[model samples]
Target: MAQYSPQYEMNRYINHYFTSHACPPQETQAWFSTPYAMMNYCQQNRIGAILPERFLQAMGIAKGYCELEPPLRLPCYLVYKKDNPKYATIQVFVDYIRRVYHIKK
Candidate 1:
């Protein structure tokens, strides 16, 4: 179990899950700040990493990692300042993203 920054939501989720699941010390041996670093470490060490599914897809090696039972889901959100003047442009961009990703508000 490689550790990422405590600030990232994914890291928080991973930490919470691991605390309840009680991973062995051997499994929780490394720490890194980015997905790329974690992925590279896992590859070189022949270990598994708890990474965003998209990361694996982006690396073109989704099949390389062994996925565990009971997959994790992370919630995503789009946020902006309510007082911003570029509301229309932001809405258009948001709409484009939703359409591209098939997301519903």
Candidate 2:
């Protein structure tokens, strides 16, 4: 089987979570900005990923229990709507993820 990159797995998790929750795809982009940002939001909000530990392990990410560089992304859209200023901040993160991780619709 082809192993997915940590970033790719994170994208799938985000997409699945938002879609299952009936969130529009556009709204999803507005929600997390990027996978890394989403992870940060999850950490802050106690919203673990589908396979929280596994996902983190795959990404080489560590949370409160581990000693690692804190992920440097933010979930601006998690607390605001698309029309809000924070949404723009999220959009920047999303763009970065897309460019850096090659996330596609």
Candidate 3:
């Protein structure tokens, strides 16, 4: 099988999925440093590629299109001053996040 291989920088202590030195390099068809690259490649080449759905979706992508449900689920947080974190930029970001996660106002 010709699948993709991970090229994570450091893996001495923690070898998460991406940084993990697993998959065969010779079998790797191509490399993607970002989720967009992975997704665009799969879409353009019509070949499936493993992707980090959390990061991708956090950046905002349409839901139900390629919904990914990774086994290792992690909690997402939006930290702010809370007192007056409602700057224009923060508001815009919060709005975008809300839209992405379908959070109710």
Candidate 4:
């Protein structure tokens, strides 16, 4: 399989998906800087990828997608670190996130 580089948000999203659900593991053979690059690699190699639907549409990739038996709703996140004392209660926000995502440990 080919996919986005480790630093890519899509990579993180996919990781979260697999971590929270049951699915066969896909071994990656290549990492690309962009989804388009991954798509090209998959096409040339006759392989598959985990490209997001939004990206496919944005890239104008004319392909059909078979929806998962039950579709999943993935959340987007925004995060930052700050030294401001006012933000010291961030743990409450963190704990809320953990509960919402059902993250253990």
lDDT top scorer: 1
Question: Could you tell me the TM-score of candidate 4?
Answer: 0.56
- Which candidate number would show the highest TM-score if scored against the true structure? 1
TM-score ranking of the models: 1, 4, 3, 2
Candidates' C-alpha lDDT: 0.77, 0.52, 0.54, 0.74
RMSD per candidate (Å) reads 3.2, 14.2, 7.9, 7.1
Candidate 2 C-alpha lDDT tens digits along 1-105: 111244554566555655666767532222443546667666677444333455577788665444223322323333457787678788887788778967674
Model 4, C-alpha of 23: deviation from truth (Å): 1.5
Point out the worst 10-residue segment of candidate 4 by lDDT.
64-73
For residues 21-78, could you state the per-residue lDDT of candidate 4 as single tens digits?
A: 8776677788888777887887788677777777778878767654554555676554
Model 1 lDDT per residue over 7-71, tens place: 77777777666566776433556778889999899888956678877779988985766674566
Show pairs that collide, candidate 1: 1-27
Weakest 10 consecutive residues, lDDT, candidate 2?
67-76
**Candidate 4 ranges with C-alpha deviation above 4 Å:** 72-105
Clashes of each: 1, 1, 0, 0
lDDT of 3 by residue, 1-105 (tens): 113334443221222533444633333566666556667776677465555566557767655355424333334567777567566788899899999989888
The residue ranges of model 3 lying beyond 4 angstroms of the native Cα positions read 1-6, 9-27, 56-105
Residue 104, candidate 4: Cα error in Å is 28
- TM-score of candidate 2 versus the correct structure, residues matched by position: 0.26
Clash pairs for candidate 2: 33-94
